[model samples]
Target chain A: MSKPTAGIFGLTGCAGDQLVILNCEDELLDLVNLLDLRDFLMATSANDTRCSLDVAFVEGAVMSRRDEETLERIRQRSRFLVAIGACAVWGGVAAQESNGNHAALLEDVYGPLGRQYDAIPARALHELVKVDLNITGCPIEKSQILAAIANLLQGDPPLLPQYAVCAECRMRENNCLLIEKGSVCCGPLTAAGCEARCPALRIPCIGCRGPADDVNTASAWAMFEEKGYTRADVDRKLRTFAPKGGRA
Target chain B: MSTTIRIDHLARVEGHGGVTVEMEGGAVRGVQFDVFEGARLLEGLVKGRSYEDISPVLSSICAICSVAHSLTSLKATENAFGVEVSPQTEALRDLLSLGESIESHALHLFFLAIPDYLNYPSAVALAADNLPAVQLGLRLKKLGNTIQETVGGRAVHPVNAVLGGFGRVPGFDQLAELRAALAGAAADCETMLEIVAGLPAASFFRAGIAFGALVSPREYGYYAGEEVTMALDGESETIPAPEYKRFTNERAVPHSHAKHSTYNGRPYMVGSLARLVVNRARLGERGLAAMKRLGLRFPPDNPTDNNKAQAVELVNDVDRALRIVESLLEHGLKDEPPVPVAPRAGAGTGITEAPRGILIHSYVYDEAGRLTAADVITPTAINAASIEDHLRRAAENAAPGEEAALTRAFEMIVRAYDPCISCSVHVVRRGHDG
Candidate 1:
């Protein structure tokens, strides 16, 4: 069988997700044999605009009207779609300014005339098109990418941990920063995967990886206020990558 | 009839830039470069915002060179308010900037430019045969990241850097680790130089093509300097940053949304090559020795040789970084609290040597110290025309008649200057006095 073709596209976010993939230093090249990177804008100008896509990975918050159209096009062409990182999965930091309720925010940003606003309110891939799988993190991890690719090659749905950062912290033998320093950490709320990077460094989790499924937002919010955090601070912290309905 | 090949979407340099190579009757006719970053209109966004609100917003103007944006913003703000950060603050900022230099330069060298030379699709493919070399690149790249993390507290959009100085300072042990690792990274620079020196470097791309960059009297301008030009034009000439617009001309090209630039209707280069050409005297002993030993011409014309020049600069930067750190510590360090002045209102400009090229940021402020206007002249935009000129010359030299090799030749020319597009987006700040 020929190699599976993958197309990576970035919408409107820091190109960090793609950078992370490019940063896979040692194993970076071996992918050519396993996957034909048919359309990555950052890598090369050579692209197959009409090729059949085996898998497509999309990064960044779907913010602009043009991006919504592009994401739908990608979804239509791709057999399987993966939302890489928190931006695509949960809208990410830039979305905070856009308001989680995409509809209301559309009115707020573009005004009530947003009703006539030609561009649809920027929404997650699932809102506009099918998202077969989602990879959650501030920036998607290499290991998860590898694992997902492996599963896809075998014709299986990709499996990734859906737990909170708390799970990873306890497993890493690191102390809980929230308890020790009285620092407000989102470890109990954020999706697990980054291995408690911020907490380990004595900084509280700012939730680069959006909220976990089982996250108790109200409880976490209360806990933060238990510390010295103001309401706005807690709001900003939880809202880094909040989904449309999650912030409220 | 002349055929014009316009590159509406020039690849991998940074942000959005385009190029045009006009071949009239198979002869070079006209070339224009432009920056097509569509009116992001960010200059208007920072207008009423406080000094504290400006950092992250400006930083996002370009993901690849956010450090430049942050530093330039800090500098212009500092200049406007007459603020002075501690020597410790200055040292850390330099270190972060140095880290960005390493990361940005390595990306441009390996991922972008080197691919054109080796005929590889990307750096990932090149890394296969050169795994160890890639690893060394990663380690060197990571050293900068470590610096950003230590000082800024986050690798991307560092929150710790602010108006007066840093929101927080690194502990002693963190500084020690960076100092030690940087000392160790010096070997990587030597190794990098050895590798580039050993690689098969193609001949000069264009002879007598002058380039310009910022250079200081006391030091090579990392943060500040006059715009110095080098070519047959002679040694360095100081054109103030505010005056860069005089030399810079932009036009809309059909090939790309990115605009093309020319200095007085002639293509010129910038970045490492420009810096190397302009600041060769500032290299002191080692830089001068490396230049002589590299056997590079007094002014190398071939665009491909810029990589070697960058490698040489890595040597210079590492050496300088070590020396600067040692001197700072030896002098018992100076810490002036970040001068805190509310925005009184004025227009100011700031320039810094972004890894790929010269980054100029200017803004006008209202009486409230809000940003009123902004203009950005990123290296990529400035060099786009020069890249086209080099490409036309390179393709003409490599294989003149064949449009088949045009893409390869074009990418090569673009990479030679190591353009960064995302850095080109701009707007002026409004001064309060206005």
Candidate 2:
């Protein structure tokens, strides 16, 4: 049997998710051996853009026409397309509430010349294409990325934790920063795979992993408001990293 | 015959960028290092957002150097609010920055550029033959990530570090662990320098370009510098960070998403090359020894030598990191809460030497602490014109009809700079006075 063909592509974000794949310093050599890696521009100069891929890990949001074209080409050639990180699954930080004046924003950076780039409002991968799996994180956590790859390699659909970050925070025996400290934490609304990284350090969750499954949106909002945060503040925190539908 | 040599989708570098060199009648007419990455108007995105949210978003500009962006953003915000952090905070931030520089340089020299020098398609191919080299690179890279994870919370986008100080400072044990790691890696760092010195010279050298980097009146440092020093053909000028616009005259250009920058009407260089050129005198004992052993001359004209410069800096970074760790451990750890911030209407600029080069973050906040205006100048943007100049010379020197060789040469030239296209295209407009 031939090894599974894999290609990791980045679109229009920090390239952090892809860097996470590289940060798998120990597993990287083994990963390349297990997968018939073809296209990973960030990692290699020898890339085959036309090669059919068994698994395509795509990061970054579709923030431009060029990105859309790149995604379409990759999607066309790949059997399993996994959206990695908050940027590809959700709109990430680039998709913040500043879309109303995106035109003005572009102009502000490039003067009138920004019009030539023909940039679109940042949108997640699923918004434009069919995503088979979604691994969410600001930069996808190392364990989660490795696990997803291992599962996919075995022809098993990767199982993502559907629990909220608060559950993991509880598991870590960390005090609830939201309730105890009255910080503007988003643990109740966030997906659990990061081991509650920020809150573990007494910092509030910025919700980089998008939304949790079966989360009570109404109660989450009420809890935040009860902790002295206004509805606007809660909404702002939610929109910071939550996917499009995850926002209130 | 005139031909346009386009290496679209430049590989083995961070983000999306390509090189387009136009050859006309054997003379290189022009060259454009096009950044195909999408315009992430991060400055615009953070317009009405609170000050705290700005760095988190902007830091995502480049994952490889996220710590640099985060620290610079925090400094800019801190400067704006007139916040003064404790020495511990300053020391820890410096340690984190050095960690990033070491990691970035290691990644570039081994995984990225070494493949080119060794004539391999990628590190994966190189690893098939040279496993130990690849393993050493991984160890060095992991060391970087560990420091970042320990200090900033996560390796990529840090969460614990905020405006005034860290949300949770690493304990004495954590600092000691870093020191032990540095001590263990001392021999490895020397081995790294040897590996760097072994590579065949890239031979892409020229003079007349300006070199710029953040300079400290104190020690050779990144975060310690409030002023920038630019040297061209032996003459140098030190400009305050607030007047960065004078040096980084950024403007938009056709055929590239990122803008081009200039100093004194000439393309200027930054990054490890510029850092070494500007601060060679202030190098620590280890760095000076490494330079002497490596036989590196001052004000190297070759961009490819940047990799070697990075290797030398890697040793220095480790040396500096160990000292910082020792200082922290000696002083004992303090669990200080983030300093209280009261935002007022004012504008401030934070400048630091990111791994790739100088990174600047400037912002204006209203009385409510909401950002009113912003401007960011990444090192890649600053090096854009300088990159083109090198590409033009490389193309001019290339044998006609050897498109493959020319393309390879151009790619090597660009990659040597380790241009982070993701970071460069964030913002260009510099005159955003609040």
Over all chains combined, what TM-score does candidate 2 have? 0.97
DockQ of 2: 0.63
Candidate 2 Cα outliers beyond 4 Å, as residue runs = B253-258, B426-434
When only the first chain is scored, the TM-scores of the models are: 0.84, 0.96
Clashing pairs in 2: none
Once model 1 is optimally superposed onto the true structure by TM-score, how far is the C-alpha of residue B71 displaced, in angstroms? Answer: 1.1
Reference-based lDDT, residue B83, model 2 = 96
Candidate 2 lDDT over B221-290, as tens digits, reads 6777799999998899999999999988876665454567888788888998899888888889999998
Instruction: Report the number of the highest-DockQ candidate.
Output: 2
Top candidate, metric lDDT = 2
RMSD of 2: 3.1
* Residues B273-380 of candidate 1: C-alpha lDDT, one tens digit per residue: 788887777875666666766778866667777887777776776677667666655665433435466786786677777777777777667778766665566776
